[model samples]
Target: MPTRIVVDPITRIEGHLRIEVVLEGNKITDALSSGTLFRGIEKIVENRDPRDVWAFVQRICGVCTHIHAIASVRAVEDALDYRIPKNANYIRNIMTLTQFVQDHVIHFYHLHGFDWIDVVSALKADPAQTSALAQSISGWPLSSAGYFRDVQTKVKTLVESGQLGIFANAYWGHPAYRLPPEANLMGVAHYLEALNWQKEIAKVHAVFGGKNPHPNYLVGGMASAININGNNTINIERLNLVKTKIEEAQTFVDQVLMPDILAIANFYKKDLYGGGVRNYLAYGGVPTVDVRNPDSYLFPGGIVLDRDLSKVYDIDLKDPKHIQEFVTHSWYRYDDPQAGLHPWQGRTEAQYDGPKPPYENLDENKRYSWIKTPRWQGKPMEVGPLARFIIGYARGNQRMRTLVDDALKKLDLPLSALFSTLGRTLARALETKYSVDHLAGFHADLVANIKAGDSAVFNPDKWDPSTWPATAQGVGYCEAPRGALAHWIKINKGKVESYQAVVPTTWNASPRDAQGQIGPYEASLLDTPLANPDQPLELLRTIHSFDPCLACATHLLNREGEEMLNLRVI
Candidate 1:
């Protein structure tokens, strides 16, 4: 008989996620991914001004903040055919790059690092040996014996005090953790360092968007005012501040993050599990020119099926056949459960037909999740860093190919190694390094544009509702830190008639569709071996690789039609 293991509300992620697996002997024979919370952002934005939808939808996930706003505004702009100035595009790109640098680093260290690193194991490390390990990897300037000792002391206090705090409740000493004590200590030290350094990156968003974790975005372009001479606007000092932050991000990625990724990946090279679905998708972002032109995207957009790199299929957001959502095994209703509806025609009618809360098990044959299954041409696709890199490499983007090839060479692994959990982790770090390298060039371009007296960031030509057609619909797409994301909007007489968001997590964490096709998370768990069923650390390793964000995946719509605010999903 297969043993059922349920891990509800998976910790260290941005929102609520539940994973259940059936263990036959030591291998996972089946798995189910569930999003416990519901997001009602789409319902909240209905009948509202299309321009104001960004502010509402940006609240989908606090961690993935600005990407939602960017998608929202881009959808509205696409509907109205509005084009932003060069400076505005540059600023948005800079902000996005900063997010990539910050989010990826934070995800690797604070969220996913715990899977491979044992905080308790770090206590056994000799501070001197840890320093040697850290110094051997990179010149991060914080590899002193005393520094390791100090960081170890902090952990010791937490351990001895019986209050592990953020380091609490983990499966320490798990057999799956492959890092040695010294490497673990080094990683733990960087974890603490990252907690402090992440604040600096947030300042970049603040300098441009006026706030962090829900920055302001405009319909046409951005809300930031570019005036190098003005104190109130994006002045010379602000631009310099942005420059310094980007530099700090680059230094941290090159010296600390990448080295740590490479060092840790070396240990888990053979643990090549969790490849999941072979299909991948990337909407692509960081526009060098206009957002509408996919060719100008720094990360090229396309699809790769069955791990094939020879052919990259073009994705059309407006085409009903390209992208569609299904609620076959989800807690939602459609006239025909088997039919997949495109975003413009997507519905969010909540229908909880599964087991109630506090139940011991969910019927996998029925609706068990709140997240909708998103498919490209009826096929489930993996999204995020791994997909972007795969598509980019397939497209022969020189920089992307060089980065991936060099990383593969360093690991002494073949390109086929990229189809595993470790590959997902490596791809994120590489993407961060690549994006950070471009931040300077983007800042330089912004400076040049402003110097040339092109400081306009907003387009008021279509600011009025009357400027919009009586009925219009458009799709805004971008690659968020997690993966490919898009918003579909239908505006009627300047008011939003319908709005749908097919977020990254929806594509990855989605449950089985009508055809009984398993989504990425579920598929990834297939045939994965478990060293200890009680600990289940191997499960965390694979799931965390995708950096799941359940809040972004499942959105709620009250059947009673009441305004939903301050509803907590414990």
Candidate 2:
């Protein structure tokens, strides 16, 4: 008999998620990923002005704020067949790259770091030995023995008082945690350092977009103005401030983040799991010339299936047959339960067919999750850093190929090792470093464009409602920090008729489709061996690698007589 285990409201992720797995002995034989909340942000933006969609849709997730706004604006622009200025494109690219660097670092240290790191063990680490270990890894300025001693003292205070705060509710002494006390101490030190450093880097978003979390964006272009001599606008001093922040971010990635990843990865080289589906997708990031041209993207877009590097398929976002969403195992209703609908014709009718609250198990044979199953050409695909890296390496991008090769060489691991849970984690760190290296070039280009007397940021040619066509539709996409994200829109009489956003987590956390194929999260967990079934630390290690954000994956739905169900799992 297989043991059924439920880890509801998965902690440290963005929103409510329940993961149910069936364990035969110590091995996971099957898994189900559930998004308990209803995601209906599309219904919220219905019949609104196309220009204002960016602001409303951006509120989907606080962590992934800017990307939604970018995608929404691009969708509106695409519908109108409008083109933005080069400077606006550069500014948008800069904002995105900055977000990637900041988001990835925060995910590794604060959100996903605890999975592999044992914070309690840091209390027993020798400060001198930890300092030596930290120094051996990188040239970080705060690697003195006294500094390590201070960090250890802090952790001791938290543990002794029984108020671990952010460090609470973790499987601290689990057998799966393999890092030594010294390495754990080093990780804890940087964890706090990253907490302090995160806010400063966010100032870049403020400098460009006016605020963090919910940054202001314009449909035609950016809302920020450029006047080199003006203090109120994006002038010389502000641009220089942006430059300084980028440089600081690059330094931190090189010295602190990369070294820590390498060190932690070295300890768990052989504990490989969570490589799912082996079908990768990236919608190309960081546009150099324009978003329309795939050739100019920093991370080129393509699809690689079954771990094949020989052939990469071209993706068309507008083609109906290319991408479709199925709700066969989802909590929504369609006229035909087995039919898959594209975003332009996607429906969001609320229908609950699962078990009531306090239920021990979900009817997986029926509907189980609020997340829709998104398939590329009728096949499940994994998206994110690993996908981007695999696609880039397959396409023979010299920089991407060289970076992945060097990292594998340092770890003495083969290229095949990159498809596991560790590979997803390593890909994110590597992509962060890669993004930082390109940050300077974008900054330089921005400065040069401003100096060349092109200060235009917004394109007002088609800004008026009178200039719009009676009916139009478009798709906007971005390779967000998590993976590929896009928003599809249909407009009529200058108002949104239909709106749908197929986010990154939806792709990775989706349930089985009409064809009965499990999603990336479920597929990855199959055959994974759990040392102890009671404490599912190994499940977390693989799931967190995708950096699951349910807030973005599942939006809210308002229905009369519908009571919100909140489950407290003890």
Candidate 3:
């Protein structure tokens, strides 16, 4: 019998999600996105001094909190037209990069690697071969032939460390697993090494942020003290190790990571070729080093679609009328569910009419998700590596096609094999490689500039809220680890009068809209045939590719009903 199979609380990703798969004889016919928890973030911000908003709002997502902090501070500064100093600008860039590295490394190895190699498989791996491979990989340490062996020892210690907090709910073994025991052992060793490298980078964040999961950076400037002899005198030797780490990481990508991607990808080729939207979007990545002109970002803005993987279009985020938050098929009580209301004024309430049947279509004029349907220029779009790659490729950037083509050849994959779970994972690793190499030179240049005596930090004294300024709005957009992320803010009386955000995962996991159009997750699930409806591991594999964060996804387990519905139909 054809029946609906929904994978509730989708694993691997950061957030909570339930895949609502409409089945008809082995194929999924439809889907719905549900962001089941609602935290009164905007409500919490109301009636508070504007200065504290950065601290509170940044807690929205542990992974991309830096971007949120940057966006919030920029919006407030824009409202007041408070121009910062040059030193402050550079400091922000360095700290933001630290956050980026911390996020990317942990996510790639610790979270994604477990799927390919089973824990038990590691027990059988040849330690000698592992050492040889580490020697060959540029970034991996091999000074002590004993280093690789030592890594295995640490993995055992970590397992017994009682800090399995990292893998508390993780699925170590699934039916789909298939790696040689040797490879599994090698992965186990690298997993421990990766964890160490992640902490190494995290210390960089700790030096500046006070903590890793969440940090402290003020709206006016940073909290850390930069030791500039006068103004432009920077502490070079102090930051050189970080520079070397970036270099080492680049080497690993070119040798170990990319090679492994090709090998593992060869096996998952079939899984690599589905769930592509062809519509790609990027939320203008982080700003460049030059403080004078920010439009020139380390990563720029634009959108690309199936027709051309080469050309990108500028996205104007400041257009209030161009954005919206729809709640039609969702479970909420609002007068105009389809209205383009700013986030601070937007309402959020969980009042499901009933458990929406998995296969049936809801009202054509309402929403079925707690996630607001955010349309860029009013259109559905996919964001993340594919989008970023398309934009960079269209611009004829050097590394774009080269990496994609090389990966395709290594995996023995055809041209049509992109945008699935494996591809997403590979794209992330590849991007980290590129960013590491790119930043190495920039960091060097920063050192040179500092030695020349130019440290610019802050240039503000005090201002009255009553006389702050007129109404001014700006949108800060950047690519979070998962995908394109954006923050839309409007300021009044020097406070966060209004704020709205559209994160990357939201793009992939949106719910049904008024027209019954499936959100990205729903759309991706349509063509994936569930082999065994009772055990939807394939469904889990696809969702985990995005690495979503349920904590930041605006959901909660209702202790009242003992109900934990992270995703549900309105």
Q: CA shift at 135, candidate 3, in angstroms? A: 5.8
lDDT of 2: 0.91
lDDT of 3 by residue, 1-570 (tens): 667665665655665565666688866676666665555465456455666777877888767777677766776665566666555666567666665555666765676666666675455556777666545544445424466567566656656775655545544555566666555666665566666666666655564566676777665666655564423223454466557666665665566565565555656677652464666777656566542353666655577765365467766556555455556666655576566554435555555663454544443344445565655655667776666766666666667678777777777775456666677767766676666666665566556666677544555543456666656565555666667766656666656666666667767676665555566666666677666667665666666666766555563223232333444433
TM-scores for candidates 1 onward, in order? 0.98, 0.98, 0.84
Q: lDDT of each model, Cα atoms only? A: 0.91, 0.91, 0.61
Model 2 bad stretches (over 4 Å): 556-570
RMSD of each: 1.5, 1.5, 4.9
Model 2, TM vs. native: 0.98
Q: Please report how far candidate 2 places residue 84 from its true position, in Å.
A: 0.5
Q: Which 10 consecutive residues of model 2 have the lowest summed lDDT?
A: 558-567
Clashes of each: 4, 2, 24
